[model samples]
Target: MLPKCIGNLSTTLTAFSSGGNRVFGEIPEEIGNFVNLEVLFMNLNQLSGVIPSNLGNLRNLARLDLSDNNMGGTIPSSLGNLTKLIGLSLSGNNFRGQIPSQLSNCRSLDSLDLSSNNLGGAIPPQLIGLSSFAIILDLSRNHLTGVLPKEVGNLRALTALDISDNLLVGEVPSSLGACIGLTSLRMGGNFFHGSIPQSIRLLGGIEELDISRNNLSGQIPEFLAVLHSLKILNLSYNKFEGMLPREGVFKNVTSTFIIGNNELCGGLPEFHLPDCISKSSKSKKINIVILSTCIIFGVLGVAVILAFIYLCWLKKKVNKPVPSLINSSCPNISYGELLKATDSFSSTNLIGVGSCGSVYKGILKDSGIAVAVKVFHLVHHGALKSFTVECEALKTIKHRNLLKILTVCSSIDYQGNDFKAIVYEFMDNGSLERWLHPSATSSHGNELPKKLNFIRRISIAIGVASALDYLHHQCHFPILHCDLKPSNILLDAKMVVHLGDFGLAKFLLGSSHDTVANQMSSMGLRGSVGYAPPEYAMGCEVSREGDVYSYGILLLEMFTGLSPTDNRFGDNLTLHSFVAAALPERVLEVTDRIPLLARASVWESLVPMKCLKNG
Candidate 1:
């Protein structure tokens, strides 16, 4: 139970968060006394009882989240008094009654989530039509009824919208297509009728769209097949008909779902859909004479083709050099070419060194394209295995925030020794480690000092998180980075982050198989010493959590400018604990001085840590 005395800080508190805790019992009504509170988060708790109506008294509140709790009772209309509120989430609760139309008065609101609740009644047009909703507006898994208001077009800035699994009826509003910022839209599990609106083509950037289990009919839209960004599309259990397009996402059955739509046909062979045939063609009867002639000709054509193929194979075997399996997936770059590109492995071209290899700046002679060449030292114990693992991992995964392999080189060097290398696009800004802690002996001594502002640091963090999310959840099979640290994070010209260095990558084959493989692979440490998780040291099986632990340490290091293995962290005191003990009050003491050099006061320096703490 929350202690009532906790509200005594109302006189000075500006923010309060107790989310994801085991706390229970009713919230203290005295919480309304925090006139200066700007943010309140108590989500993912066991709190119950009605929201204290007096909460509306906190007129300065800018964000309020009490979601994923056992809280019940109607949403109090008094909440309308918080005109400055920017986000309000009451989702995953037992709250009953209609969504208070008064919530529309929060003109600054950008995100409103009332999903997974017992709320019923028509979705208030005033609330749904709020143009201030720029981030998301989720009312899914509720008892909402009536058509989505046409005024939804007013929210042209909204990025995601979900009204799935509701009592909604009528056509999907064409006005929704006007919100061109949408990346995900789900209106499935409802009674929505009619064809997909033509205006939907305007949302060219939509990535995940689900309109399944509805009454929508007509040919599956050709526009969907042309949506290059479309990844996960669910059109199942609808009345869609006609030939499914063979282009774009339709060609990948694993990412697109069309099951239960009986009339749909002519998709990928993996879909096992019936061949689409015109009515006239289906009704025509073939003559026996023509059929026999076609059979004879087809056999003759097959025999001729086989003979030609065999002759071509024999000639090629004698005339051309066969490509290696590694070269088959990548461009056919010879070891000699890589050697020339790196100026015969000159010391001047060396940019970074790794456990198994050295990365050199190089330029392809023919194309004049700048590249980063990672040439493995084959003599190193695990260098061969590292090169193989990196190639296997890179070939299967591709994402904007993850590094891209341009080609691979596998052949004999001038000495007739095995040579292995991986080439990647050159990053102008270089690795995160160089910026976070510049070396006094850096080759570029004439260059000015480098620093990352608060915003840039946050952007880098988000990019790294996105890359990890893709590897862990969005791949054909789960992949674990195993190694995530500052040195592995690269920055491009625009300062966009790209996660690289996958030599320690591991594919999770499934639960039991993964455990056995992990144990076998645990013969050595999975990642660098300080960044690896403690459980890994005990021979625990590799899991996604291991990556997250490394990411957490990376975050602390990013803001504090202190490595996990920094000498200051000794005895029982670690970097994480050192920072944790100085937060909210002594935030500036532990934070890197670079971000604070331009700040005016202690309050200004707290911005970054405040956001991290609240989240």
Candidate 2:
């Protein structure tokens, strides 16, 4: 909303020579006709529009600053014609374009900035001059590409250089090691490759350094790892390889430095890897070995030997157990007793696919107890990680409606092997999805239960919403359920809702970035397509609001018997909008018939863009 032109204002006063005068409003296009104007000082103004091309007529212009404006569009190419120009800054504006290479021809040009714009293209290579003493240079966040020219090393006077966030590639020029006077160097989030030049290792006066999120490879230069004066060093998400030399640098890192590479393994503190192999792969092999020993001994051992082992194992089994996703008995469980309880885990005893495992209804003969046993899948590492996270989270989760995790066995069989499983309080009724969208029912594949009535459906919806709200917002750390479909929600004997499946739950309390949910654009369109929000496509940093959006869609489906992702959203559409349109005279026509049989909210608080949102 800056003033369009100066002539539109009431003031036009030419000040006495050599006096400092303050002026307001935007520069007029006609002002370029100030033919004798040699010292233009419109540095900070609420100005709009590009500097007039006619301003290039100031043959003797020394200092020019049209900075801090609402200016849009390209910097005029004509400005470079000023042969006598000294200081130039079009900084901090909406102005965008490649730095005119012609300005470098101005031999006397010094101080430049075209930062924070949507400009694109490569930095000009031939622009560096030996005679010109350019001081400050900043060209960050533009779409500029290509390598930083080695000629820049010739700028012995250049104290600060920031070309961060551009598409520049290649190694940090070796000659940069000679720039001992450099106070700040920020080249983050680019494609610069190769190791940190060994020559730069001697930069004793350096204060800041950031080379994160780039393709830079090779071990971090050893000399840099020991620099005490350095305040910040971020080499995260790069291709840096090889075990860090433990005795020297990186020994006392205080700030965050992520070095997670697939090959850079086993050398860290948490990952106690053996010299024989990498940590992750070694853990997998150890698990395999433990599994083999348990199986071999189980088949050959006699009853006496088994009894001795069981009592001995019990002493070690009752302590806090290792985390697991599938709730099952301890690894050294009484296999024979469990087998007898399930009639040898018979097909008749099989229940459902519970999470990453198969569930079986078992009754202990000795105790006359009913329990559900979930067996781990043969090959599911994803299921394994999920199992571990859930075990940890559920250890603290104690809710009446939720399915309670009882215990899990983490030992090997008589053969001296390891198998994972968990035990949970069983539910007579399965998931809500089974009743609402029943395809098949019962382990015998019998007909699904009768369709739920309106009253029951609303109850289920309310329960589901409450569970979702708790998980999404009320938990100690807000847990984001990336997947929130009906099948994942279960009900108890009392018809109380208990949300299951934290396989995709992410703690959002202090997360700086949205993860897992972001890398889901492929695999036939991400996140169940219809349920995912629109902003997800733009990678706009998803929040708990996404879960809220999914819940709203579910509520809409509960009342309308139509999927929210259906093709009826905008054409006089949306369950909420459609229902609201039929208000006043006949709210009945707009009602979700299931709720018609029960007391409804009356939607007395409903309005446009209200709680019952469509988008």
Candidate 3:
């Protein structure tokens, strides 16, 4: 017996199970006092009498199982109160009377089994139409009567259904075809009559079908042979007649079992069935004439369909607009047009080499709009993937600090080889790398030595930070800039920084709180050697913290005018250590003298000597 003292525990208890035990006698009424219980299992026991109606108090209950017991009585209608119940099983018991229509209130029920009981009365139409019944619905070996409800079609996700061995009458509901996912259907040992519905052909995924021992009449459908997934079909002890189909699963004798149908004949020779005799000559002539007429009409229909399709294709070609870019709202340019604008990719038009490809300066012939075209080298590893990633990243993101893609070209070149490129608004001032370390020999006639003041450097840093912040927090998906260095940062005519080069970008699928260990990456280590985080070398996953480390290094390089890759630092000394050692006393020793002297007055106002002395 369930101890009455068990109910004395705290109301916080959420589960109580006493199944498969020798425990007997009436369940103590106090058992229902655990109002907070969400799961109550007392199956496989000898507990008798009706289920406690007070169980309705568990409004938060999600599962209740009481099968294989000696309990006798009508199912408690109070179970309807479990609005959150996802599974309810009360099969293999002595419970009788009509199934409670109140069960329809369990809108969350996915699996329900009330089989092997003495349940009587018509099956509730509301219960049959419960859309949440996705897993299984077993009401077999019951005493249910009357026609099967048409509402059974509502179980679109149900995989298995067993309503066999019942007292149900009338034809099986044709709407059962709506259960397209059904893998097994058992309706045997019933009083169902009439020919099997033609809609049964729609159960293309059915693997097992049992409709034996029924009052069903008419010839077995030839369409049954075409259900490729069917493995076992049992039509024994039925009133089906006529010759059996010889194709598909029907050809295998062991897979199909049909017995006690005396009128059936002419199956495989293994069945030892009598041969079907030929019809009279007059009937043969009629069949030949019908077959010849059908062939003529079928040929004419095919020719007509082909001619109509050809006419539609010709019409579409004549009126089709010029081939444009992916986003049709923008101006369109073809591959040949871009090639001519770039002077056939001449060496004079070359701008710079990137991670995946080379950049070329070009001007549109009609509009004369200067643009930078990046052509990807398909043979290089990860080159195509980088182009695809960059395109996808730029399409959904837009900001003043982010590079804008004017258009893209995905077509064949003059030599018939594949070509892929992206065009973007030209940055006249070139990359931050060129600005920081000017080349002695200039290719472009307008090339001039450029320098950034202290204030300009701060503004550029703020712009890059704003772009990174948007990518990490504001977007629908977080984007990680795997590479963050001076070369990837561009400056326009006004010296406004624009973050570009998303070739190695990664979009995180998880939330911000997820640990770096849980993140995934196909590229091994990210960022350049000195700028990359220390954890990256250890094969640890990448995170936003890695980007912050790179930014910190970049900031240090800006003020010190020393690259992290400079040969001055060797085994023991790094850029970080070098900057750390030169603190308050020797700070000006490592500073960039040219820019520092130009902004001396601003530096004095920004950083007082007293603050450095106190530190």
Candidate 4:
């Protein structure tokens, strides 16, 4: 009794021609009586009982959906008799046991999502022939194991294929790269360890590639650097070694991206990691404290005062042994004329602020050259000595990564207020910290875009290190960047890095052995707490190792894509402590955000944090 057969047949009767009074119970096997039926859709009811094997009598049936009901037991083997069936969806019910492979003879399935169930065993490779031209394949989040067939490349028109979160292994078949139109590849978080094929990089149009958290080895092919169109690339926590690709997409990025893998090196100064110019140009701070006899030592406050005095001295000494912006005699612009051009110290034109004064983006009245004009704090009789020392030190030192102080402006305001200002080469990109976490400006989108990748991040680290190397070993006198942090390192138009804000501690102590250094061999106490070397905090002498610690923190930030103080880390976690926690094992726990997604897409689950700790 298949419902009521009297009202059930029409030539087009197909699946449900007659309502048959909507009796909610077991589908009667008698429905097989409809010999001319071409479609059957008896799903979503309280129907139960085995699908009658005799139902195959409907030779013309093209679609069958017996899903979402109380159906049970094995699929009727007679379903193989419906040679015309093109669509079959019996999912979401308590079907039991093995699927009869004989059904593959039907030869026409276009879309299938039979996931989220207990159906086990390897997907029969022969099923690829079932749909000669259909698309949309999804078999994710299941327990199915064994290697997927390389024969899948036969689906030349596949736009999207998701086979993630499974126990599948074996190399990602090179044949799949034949899908030239494929985009968004995720093959991370898996045990498919091997060098990636160059054919994948040959996919010129791919925008995002994640192959992190795996056992990949060998150098990242230089060819990958050619992916200029890529927006995010993740290859962290793998066994990649050697320097990063220094050309193509690797060359132009400025973000801190790579981390985890430790063998990577090279990337000399002026070397742009993949895309950034090398370590030769990235800025470094030199903290050389010269404790002086000055009173009112509120420490930070007095340091501020000392910085102000040296800045004044820095004016006359902008360039002595070092090259000056101009070779000619000092071009003096009267204070009155600069006052007028700056609109009487107007706040609107103000562009920056520093220890001793406010910086205004000003135009010189004499030559009309646009420059960043830093106006120091007011003139004081007692502070004049410290100011001169800064001017002189900045003048004698010369390096491409150091800021270029142009000239000074001095004059009296209408109220007889004494003013002094120094002009410098305008850094259009502002500070490194700002660029890394940029605030959107009116002209450019704010927020540092995910432009940095493994190669570029390494380049940035090396560049900063190189700068510090020069200060510690290459300079006439050793200098320590007492205040090293992301905020003070600056970036330029081409994403080249530069050092700014030279501290004046050595100046307040009056120069020479009286200063922090006795000459070129000075090992002084200078640096900020967060990035300061451990020994320095313990009252031991500072070393390049302190700068190295800061650089390490900076490196961790780039790789983890998290700040040193993010909640993701425990309370005692500095970037060092956090990274150390993830080290020797469990390193997969640290990843750039973009790569994490890629790893999950291309691999199994979040790589077991156990890999980091146990392996």
Candidate 5:
């Protein structure tokens, strides 16, 4: 609730901010009297009701942010009156109806965000395609539909543009390539079709690009590999085909994602795809026609004999039993060794418990090396299968940030009962869950502190991102850790992250990112409550997007020191919404006190105050 008395300061006040508070109620129309105000921020609050049209009266306002509120109704066309405005953010709200085309009048504006709202209808070409945006222009996660106008090329100074997760249709315009300054471009999760525009080759400085989960078809462009500045690329779940180029970004398997394109073949050996048939091979086969008739007949006779021999070999293979594990290279450890290491599964050694099993801390008898032994409860419905799936996932992928499997044991115990366990290098720092909520979950004698500082949290996040990037792109078969939570994130003595727990992991079959090899066998909810994406609860199949959603929640929890299942969260309010309500301005208030105590001025220093004032 802003006080109406503040209006009296309209002539003297240069800036006013009431963001990231629990303030509610409509903004008083008297606020429009602030003719001298240069900056106004009321974001991340509970404010309801329509925006006051009178706000446009602030001709001097250079920066305005009223995002992440409950404000609804059409955006006032009066906003176009702020011809001097440079930045405007009205995202994550209930605002509905078409965007006002009159906004194009803000000729000086360089940054704008209208994402994550109910705003629909065709994008106003005049407002977007004609703007001389220099920083960022994000209109994603809305219901907006229609073709992206070619006039968008006018924003040649823009560095980032995102229109993903919308209903946008039609081919991407070639004119978009004219925005050569763009470093990040995302147009995924749309209805876009046809080939990627050839003009994109002009965007030599582009770093990150995502156009996945669309109707896009055609061979992936070779120019993408030549874009040396390109670091992250996602072209999955489309209709791309033909040989994948082996140069530049394509050679770095971890940075590129291209699954769900069945016709694609021939890249690095890591992709495990069939060799591409060259034109020379076809010419050689046709040359056989020039051979003598007797030679052709002799070739047909040899083929028949080889076919019979192949049939006999196939018959022998059919009778052979299939091996349970895909990887047999792992050293086998017996039940006796595990019993000696874990002290006969002593309760004193138990460190953690999960859906499929319990983890025990142990030291190998011979090497005296510390390890964490995960012993599955075979009595549990899916425990045996979970063990097998984990083993296969671990053996197939190797990454620095991923937990390393030391050995595995699969044999009968003294009671003649089945025993299965996996050994991993012990993480001395323990799970991220313990550190984030130390008071609630930390074990006695745990030496780690309750709060992680700013630099530490960022490092952990980067480590986790690297591990996920490898699993989703670099692996021969993309793996989805259906369950990603703070508990699954471990840290070593050096505080480096190690992502563990693959009990519910799913392997994408063939080249389809959405089709799992054993989906039916692992049916039901795909992840832990609170962390799982909403679609999983609706019976949707597992997807890479789902893992990303869980990761987002985990990241929020890490910095906020609040769990997704925190008692404070309710039906409408979530960890996501709570954070959304206090971004940029109230960020420090919602942040875990640990980081702020270490350094309070970090975030404030990052704000581009010069741009806000000069523009």
Candidate 6:
């Protein structure tokens, strides 16, 4: 016998699973005292008696599986109180009575199985309206009767629905066509009459459909031939007549069972059906003539329209004035060419957005070269200046670690806007920001955590350093990169870092004027917050030393996995101060463990001491 003292352990219990135990006895009513229980699985047991109504006290219960038990009683109406219930399986039991309509209150239910029970009465309309049923809803092998409700269409996300082996009657609901996500539907072994609904064609993703052993009478739907995703189809023991489709799943006689439908004719030779006789030979000839006439007229109409549109496009091209390139060193790509390449600057092509402009991924039609087009938003303050500075800075510099500028578009757009765009070689991989902080949701709705190895981090740091070294010392006129951050660092297919975004770049010229730097310095802050040095906050001129300060912070962020702008840092506590406290001993605590593990061999030999000393 189960201990009644189970209620004493209920206060802290979140789960009580004793599945497949074959525990013979009535489930202790005290089991319901577990108010915090989220999962209660006692399946494959010989437990009997009424399910404790007190189980409803578990408001957090997400799953309650009591299948394969000898429990014989009405499902507790109080169970409906579990609003967070995602799965409720009471199958393979002797429970008898109408399924509680109160179960409809479980709005989060993804799977609900009450099969192999003595459940009778009309299927609950509220139960059929559960749109969250993305998994399975099996009520098969039961004494369920009456017409299937149109509310079944509300289960648009349902993948599988098995209501077979029941006493269900009346025509199949046409609203079932709204279940477009259904991959499997089983309504066989029932008394369903009338032709298959034409709306059934909407289930283009159906992989398995079993409507066998029904009173269904009509020609098989030809649209079934086009449901390419279908793998198994059973139309056996139905009253379906006429020719079976010879395409798609129907072509495979073994996978598609259509036995006992005596009137059915003309399918794949493997089906061994009687040949379909042609009855309207004269009408068929007239129909063919009409179709041929329509085809000729349709072809002629399409050709004329296409020719007129092409002529209009050519005339517009001839009238449009071509914009000149900013410099002879780079290619001269027109605004129209780029507009066509990026689908007129569609949001889908947009890759990144900054204070001054948005970057779009484009492929030139003429050369088939993939490029990144940085289009300046002229409406923003200092945007035009950023554009000019970038063009001037990029034209003078050339380095492996630097972003390669392919061309510059200083032109007016079709909308008569002051459009200025700079084109660069497209980076196959995205920015370092994404790698540093990967999102929980992806395009495919999967959690993808991006990991950067120690070696790759070192390589990126080295590449950025090389680009900075070139700008500060190797350039004809030393340039100061005012803004240097992870977002500005782009990676290629080989993971080679390209230091980009020279919008705030200042050229250091040995002159008395100090015009550009002086004007930019007056803007208060030069670079991103936390990245701009402390001196910059005091209205100091942007310099290579400031770049070095930002670089130090960037390096700290890469290794320690703590952003300088993280909420933890404040007035007294800075990223530098935080790291200083951790020092050489507690450095392991501050840094990311994953990369540290990857570079374990080099930690003592190369990284720790040097990073501590420099960082």
Cα RMSDs of all predictions?
24.4, 19.8, 27.3, 33.2, 22.4, 28.3
Tens digits of per-residue lDDT for model 5, 1-615? 887886777486789899999999999988898888899999999999999999989999999999988887779999999999999999877676689999899998999999876566789889887657999999876656788988899899989999886667799999989899999999976779899999999998999999986779999899999999999998987889889999988988899988778789899989776788899997887776656556788888999999999989888889654433212344578889888988988998998999889999987786777789999986675565567567657755789999988888766789987678999989998999988998778567755556688878989999999999999998866899989998999999999999999878988865432221252233357789999999888888888999999999989998888999999999999999999999877887898887875554565466666654463
Tens-digit per-residue lDDT, 219-319, candidate 4 = 77877777766666667656777777666656544422345556666443443234333454443211112234233357769789899999888877866
lDDT of 6: 0.83
lDDT of 6 at 401: 95
lDDT comparing candidate 3 with the true structure: 0.80
lDDT of 2: 0.60
TM-score of each: 0.47, 0.46, 0.46, 0.37, 0.49, 0.46
Number of backbone collisions per candidate, in order? 0, 28, 0, 45, 1, 0
Candidate 5 TM-score, true structure as reference: 0.49
Worst 10 residues of 1 by lDDT: 513-522
Candidate 1 vs candidate 6, TM-score winner: 1
Residue-level lDDT tens digits of model 1 in 1-615: 988787777466899999999989999998988998999999999999999999999999999999988887789999999999999999877676689999999999999998877566688889888888889999876656678889888888999999886757789889978999999999876778899998999998899999976778999888988999999899987889989999999888898988778898887889989999877775564455577778799788999999999998888778654432222244449988888988998999999998889999998877767889999986665565566567657765789999888888766788866678999988998899988888632577786677987677889999999999999998755889998999899999999889999888887856332111222252278888789998988888778999999999999999898898888888888888899999879988988888665443443566776675675
Writing each residue's lDDT as its tens digit, candidate 6 over 349-385 gives 9888999999999988866678899999867756755
**Location of the lowest summed lDDT over 10 successive residues in candidate 5:** 512-521
Per-model lDDT: 0.83, 0.60, 0.80, 0.57, 0.84, 0.83
Looking at model 2, residue 468 earns an lDDT score of 68
Candidate 1, after superposition: displacement of residue 280 in Å?
7.3
